[model samples]
Target chain A: MTPKRKQKLFVILGLVSLAAIAVGLTLYALRSNINLFFSPVQIAAGEAPIERQIRAGGMVKEGTVARDPDSLDVAFTVTDYVDDLEVRYSGILPDLFREGQGVVVVGQLQPDGWLKADQVLARHDENYMPPEVAQALEEAGYSPADYQAKAAEVGERLGAEAVGESGN
Target chain B: MWSFIHKLGSPRWFYAISARLMPWFWVAAALLIAVGSVWGLAFAPADYQQGNSFRIIYVHVPAAFLAQSVFVGMAVAGLVFMVWKIKVADMAAAMMAPLGAAMTFIALFSGAVWGVPTWGTWWMWDARLTSMLILLFLYLGVIALRGAFASRDSGSRAASVLAMVGVINIPIIKYSVDWWYTLHQPASFSVTSRPTMPLEMWAPLLIMVLGFYCFFIAVTLMRTRSEILRRESNKRWVRDLAVEGR
Candidate 1:
């Protein structure tokens, strides 16, 4: 290759590398802000600021949803199995919002640590299957319930261990 | 190898070869998309949760895949043009910009429509969505940069540099859902993992993706041939071909 052509190639490579590095640094600096929502664990650990609008996401705890018969008000406990955050909203939830499914709520964090949600969005997982296949899986006792139970059991054990360590 | 590359870089060679290849691509695209659309919309069963709205995946996924793939292809073409001084590569890249932008718009629009039913909102400034939006802007920027300069040589070089630099966004878009807590889900298809979707559902999606790729190639070839003719109109071969048409 001619020296001039080789030099032009090197310049192009250098420019692309410089641009990549710049973008990588920018994304790294904004990593926390780039996340769509904080997890229930992060909120529980007080990483989420109070009195400011923010988003928190986690699985909807099974059997924790309460709905008002006369109003659109609803309350649910969002849990990551390690921690739980209570979310109160007064609007219609998405069609996919249900027990054992992932959800994200946007609202202000009250002084008491509850999320007073103005918006609730359901987070779909990567799994896609036909209705009949899903029904078959449920009938075969291969349901998300088993996974939820295992996660809850692990959470309970971790809590118990923490308590024991505190007693010492 | 050098001679082969030089031959490949020739506009006349590409114009001749693509004329023969274009018909095959057009036919394949038409047949695959026709069969895939029918199978996806009519034959595939509704999702357990999403129901009928899930059928939009047949369109949305293929557009999104092409959107990203076209950007990468454009960047690669830009690199070839810059390194080898291939006018054919630059011409192809120029033709690809609008199509890439169109694909990105289609993906964003279809995704927003799908989001209304499933996520309860039409838009959110999530990582994946935001990065894809940036990709659309990058495509526009490349197109605009190409035409802004007075000299065609400088314009092509400027556009090539921009395309190469903007390609950093492609990986960010692909990995956004996995890296951050976005409302967008991760991809169902993976090279190494077991398929999340059943054959009845994913088969049509695969066909649609292949159809979209063929369509991209066919359209780019058609457009690039016109670009060659317009740019090389003063050359003897082009004038001869023009006269031969008469």
Candidate 2:
């Protein structure tokens, strides 16, 4: 082989080995952070820092829904049966949020145990639920529809206009 | 350990080991992914809330997990190249760029599928999605930079620098919500909390995660081996190894 060819080969091999080591190390080091989206039950338990912005997800509790008369602020409860959390958000609530449906809120935990939501998200369709929330419900022996169907009347009142607008 | 380290530093040794290991990883990854996906998608109970759409998690979470992991992998390769001056590391880094980018694409695509049902919109400038998009760009940058240079050595070095810089940004990306009033939600899972998923649900997830890792290892090794063979084709050992078999 020519000397130039040997040198080129050497350089290529060196780069390949370096890339492998990088990947191996990265997988090992950030395993914890990468797994952060898996389980919602842990987030609600305050296993993650309360001060850190985090997601709380579950079905909106049947009768715990509340709203502020004057502001975009709305408050509701999310439950995984054994554990329940109150989530308060001041925003244009997503069209899908209502009694019994699945929801995920991102916010900080206030001292009073309420989740002060910076954002609220509702599940998109009749058949789809947020993966995390659905997982939580299945584990809790609850179903999203069981809670969702009961609140249909109220959900319709809140969601009707928004749903129509989105259809356009 | 020192001797072992020396052996590992040898490109031929690394290539041979990775080559032998690739088949096992491919088989294991294929089996596990098949089983886990079938169980999660077909056998798992429909979500009480979501019914069937929640099935998207079967693909979304695993892809996102792989996407994040690839960047870290690329960065570590950069570190080795920087310190040890290993050319193989650069090749590995370059190979990872395409695979990582593919994973990121899957994650974004699956996330959108999942999002359409949950978020009431297909896209959001939210933290998680945006960070993921940034990660995609980083992968593209690495790949592009590697090809930009006239010298392979210079190209690898430039790509390594980019990978290292991107690694530093991971934390900032993860914490973007806390640092700013971004629309993205905070994390849902944590190290401290008891996993909220039932054994039925989480069991498959664990399988899928392991399978994804195995798949990554297999593909990377395959790519790396091709790289090694291509680079070392002129060597006497590589030539003799091939000729002797003939």
Candidate 3:
């Protein structure tokens, strides 16, 4: 082979091998740790790793939030409308965090079967269907077409309500 | 294969070719960004929770994506320079560093701003935020290191090595929120991953992401051409073009 061809072969071989090693190492290291959050169903199915910090994400069950009368401690149940996990947090929550909103709590599960959350983040309010919720909804057979059509139907109902309210 | 590399290595050949490509990218960038920005800010329905503040995602997500992508692009160019002794690759890497750095800054700034009203904090040294900060530093380090060396060849080689080494950080930045406990949300836009948003909300964001990519390409082509003229001023072909004044 000519010198140029030899150099090209050498470089390509070297880079491909280097890239393969990098990919191999990265996949191995990240495979177990790649989950950003766990759902109530995953926890119920004994899939969530225990005692290690991970996020538990689900909707805050309606009327389940209980705040301490004197302190910042708050307790709530997170549910996918399928299974439920109880989360107790002692710190102030995000302003947008409220009852029935999608939430993620960062903490570890106590052996007693409750999540001791160091931080609780409400994903947003009632109307905000975050990607996690969207995924969950999809698993339940909801699609974008269904969501858009439902939104239009709601918008029309709201418009009619406003018109009647003004007429009265 | 050798002939293709040889042709691409020539500044005159690249300059002529990229001139043809750049205009199309510029036009596309302008049209897409304009349309995406308008659609996202006005036409898209307000979020049920955050309301209009969520519109920032149009600029923020695209900026953050580009910031990481440009760093990886710089690393590939550096690898090309190191392995093949490609002068054009080194030139492109040098031009890309500052732009990548600027994009990283924008992403961090926008993220921080978005946080104040949402997270109620200006900053947090969480995994995602910290990794992105390190990416910005890596970009600056490459730019500064390249300029620090007295010999151009040594500087180019040094920058290439740094760029290639920094390649490890790209995936870390991408997966940091997922792998570690952090307040920052996980990846939103993925080919295999479905966004929680309905089509109305995410469509403008997709357009914005495409526009930002075109913007990166158009600017990189313009800057690389400038670098070529500066580096190859002594070449006969460059001198002829200057003489023709065309």
Candidate 4:
């Protein structure tokens, strides 16, 4: 109701609208350039942005990795468990890189849908629980014995799978 | 309508009310965080893939969420201050900037640390990482701008404008994982979508998020009360209260 307040309100309204316009313009201008990584399914659906530097990410399909006999060049297929993409790279892979692991590749996508990767980065699984997080779970109907048992169960399964793998 | 507005806008009135409210928020914060932390760190199953390191999400994601949310809250408060000449709102915004900046740093540090075991690196020039970094700078910029101006009124106004402008980055940071190729993973939490994770994996995270919010509220209330005392020190009531303390 006061004139002084009225003046300040007008200034705020004017500037906020100005800021909104700026954001709208930025979003509109950057529309085509905002290519986040494409998933395997997206790529298979031909939704990947073509001919530009882009990223494709998915799990490395099991047993789909092959290495050259005498070179550093390697080939692998990345899949979303539905569609698959073949990635070829000559660089030394990250230490964590392996078959059946999640990985993201940055490179060019060909018209034929092959990805020539210039770099490969393994997607790390989030795995750490701090003291507080551990404490909270304790109050949430948690039992240490049961948790350890479940972990052991998973370990046993993993060990069995590993043995089966080595036998092959 | 105006009576309620006038009462809330007064520093003295806010100080009294916030004093009453702060205790509950503090208690809730401590309890929620205590529970969230224990659950997230111990009882929650190790990630099928990342194992123990994923537990950092308990702090990392909540801090990141706070970093972005604090910035938005500051901007809204700044807007209220600028438009309505509400000193209380500006005081709240000023108190929040440092906390916001700290949360941004925590998010960045945790993200970097989380990167090593998974991405095999400590830092990347990736989009999500980069935009989040910019969010840090935006917080710092508002803080610095507020301090830069000689006149308090002008300084507050400048900070308000800067906060409004900088808020544009919040959405950019949110969508960066989806909008650009980044080493950072996409959000496990979404408002319009279901969590990609199972209930057990995400329950602790939800608690952490809520705990972080409570922590922010409690801290902001405490600090804003301090600011009120500082700014209104010359006022009769403030001086009377101070003398009464002795």
Candidate 5:
């Protein structure tokens, strides 16, 4: 190749590397802010601001969901296994909202340490199987409860890793 | 090898070759998409949880895949144009920009529709979604930059630089769910691991993804041919072709 063309290629390479470095640094600096929601552990560790609107996400703990028969009020404890955060909502829950499911609640933290949620969103996992397959698995003793437990375990591990990385 | 590269860089050679290849791509795209849509929407069983709304994956996933792939393809084309001074590559990049933008829009729109039923919200400022949105803007920026400059050569250079620089967002988009606590789920398909989805569930999605890729190639080739004709109208071969058509 000619020196001119080689120099042009080098210039392009240099510019791209410079841009990559710039973006990498920017993303690193904004790492905490880039997280969509605080895990129960993060909130418990006081990483989340008090009385400020924020989102907390984790698995809905088994046997922790309570609903009011006469009102739209509901209360549940979201857990990452290491910690738990109680969330209270007064609106219609999503169709997928149930025990042992992952959920993200958006609201402000009260002085009493509970989340008064204005909105609750269900977060689905990557698993996608037909009803028949899921039923077959369930019949084979791999019950939905077991699946939920496994999901909770994964969430707990991910949560712990997130806290560890961001705590620095 | 140098001669082969020069031939490949020639607009006339690309026009001739793509003319022969376009029909095959069009047929593949049509047949694949048609069969995949029917299979995904009608044959595949409903999800145990999301139910019928999960069928949207046939459209959403393919579109999202194409959206990212098209950006990467455009950037590669830009790099070729910049390094080799290949007018064909620049023309192809120019042709690809609008289609890439369209694909990104389709992905975002279909995702929003899917999110409403599954996530209980249409939009969120999550890492994956946010990075995907930036990708759409980057596509628009490249197109706009190309058209803004008075000189076509300058415009092409600017667009190439912008496309190359914008490529950093692609990896971030791919790993956003893993890197951050995003509402978006992690990718189901990965080269390194077994897919979480069953074969019955993912087969149609795979077909749809292939169909989208064929469609992209067919459309880009078609548009690039027109671009070549428009830019090379004064050339003898083009004039002869026009005369022969008459």
Candidate 6:
């Protein structure tokens, strides 16, 4: 190769090597932080440091919820069925939050073992179902068939009224 | 003055100066990192609220700082390449990609780790977090665009444009937390604001930031030097350097 061409080729090759080294070093340096994610069970088993803010995911246990009358703070229980944690949230609960739903609470553990949450996240279900209440119910071992049937009945009544109006 | 800038822009001149300083950068990075890490990790008192887990901030904060600062550096490099037609500037911009990306990832990951203990969630779409995520994507896009073209020059030019465009977004991202309701807190440390942290806390953090910059320079120089060698491989000096050593 000509000198100019060779120089260009060398430069490109060198950059690739440099990038590789930087990436390798960074990963090596921060390996511990990278492995910090843990499940609720792992956290409860003392695998995670108690003082660290951790995420607890699973169903909000039914009938364990209480909202402070004066404050916006709401307290609820979360369970993986095998392990359970009480979580207190002092913010606006997402519209989807309810009993027996799959929710993730992000916050730190208080001295009393209750999860003091900064945020509460509610994930919806597939099949066009608003998983908010249902997920919570399902987590609490309740069937959604009753709610679904009630909704269908309401829809049918509305449809009948619309048809009568067209005929008139 | 313009000629001076042009002279400094020369790869040969940069190679000479950077080579002279590379060892010093390495020494500084190593020493500062060692001292800061030791002080911050081992000696720094546990946060009144967070206890010991807050120690991660020593690395996390520095990485976060470097992640943002390097992009600014890359953007400056992009501007030089566009205005002055400096190939070295383009090269610097290109070289910054992986480093910036890695630092961004480090910041994100460390933030997540810190979040889990303090906030209780592994991730959130908070303003600062979201902006940092976009920065990661921007870094990826620049690197990808640089390698996308059939011709290397075309690739570098494309990457330069992308870098400049992304630079415009940085200020928007930085100010978004203040403007918008965000779960992420506003910046704790700044050039003007009185630091919220005590001397013990802020002191180590400052040392870490300096160490990170030194580390950045050391790595960049090593990469740039290697780049020079590879690009100039067929040149007489490169051949002699290779042959003399081998």
Encode model 3's per-residue lDDT on B24-133: one tens digit a residue.
Answer: 99999999999999999998877645667788788988998899889889888887777667789889889888888988999999988877767656576666887799
**Local distance difference test scores for all models:** 0.89, 0.71, 0.77, 0.81, 0.90, 0.71
Summing lDDT over every window of 10 consecutive residues in candidate 2 chain B, give the lowest-scoring window: B180-189
Clash statistics: count for each candidate: 0, 39, 1, 32, 0, 22
Q: Cα RMSD to native, each candidate? A: 3.5, 12.8, 11.2, 10.2, 2.1, 17.3
Give the top-scoring candidate (lDDT): 5
Query: Candidate 5's residue-wise lDDT over B77-109, tens digit each?
Result: 998899878899999999999999999999999
Estimate, for each residue in B1-246, the C-alpha lDDT of model 6 and write its tens digit.
867666668777777778788999999999999999999898776654455767888888799888888998997887677655777777778888899999999999998887765554667765567778989999999999999999988888788767766765576456655544344555667777877556777788899999999999899888877787777678787787788894
- For this target, which candidate reaches the highest DockQ against the unseen true structure? 5
Question: How far off is model 2, as Cα RMSD?
Answer: 12.8
Interface DockQ of candidate 5: 0.82
Model 5 backbone overlap count? 0
What is the lDDT, from 0 to 100, of the residue B175 in candidate 2?
61
Best-first order by TM-score: 5, 1, 4, 3, 2, 6
Per-residue CA lDDT of model 1 for A1-168, tens digit only, reads 789889989999999999999999999999989999987767766678998999988789989999999999999999979899999999989999999987889999999989999999988776788888889999888873343664466456645655665578
lDDT of 6 at B173: 59
What's the residue-level lDDT of B63 in candidate 4? 99
- Give the DockQ-based CAPRI class for model 6: incorrect
TM-score of each: 0.94, 0.64, 0.72, 0.77, 0.95, 0.61
> Lowest lDDT 10-mer window, candidate 2 chain A?
A35-44
Q: Show model 6 residue runs off by greater than 4 Å.
A: A1-168, B1-5
Candidate 2, residues B93-177, lDDT tens digits: the string is 8888998999999988987776766575667665567778989999999999989999988999888878876775566565654
Candidate 5: CAPRI quality band? high
Candidate 4 residue-wise lDDT, B82-169, digit = tens = 8778899999999999999999999999988988877877886776887888999999999999999999989998998899878888
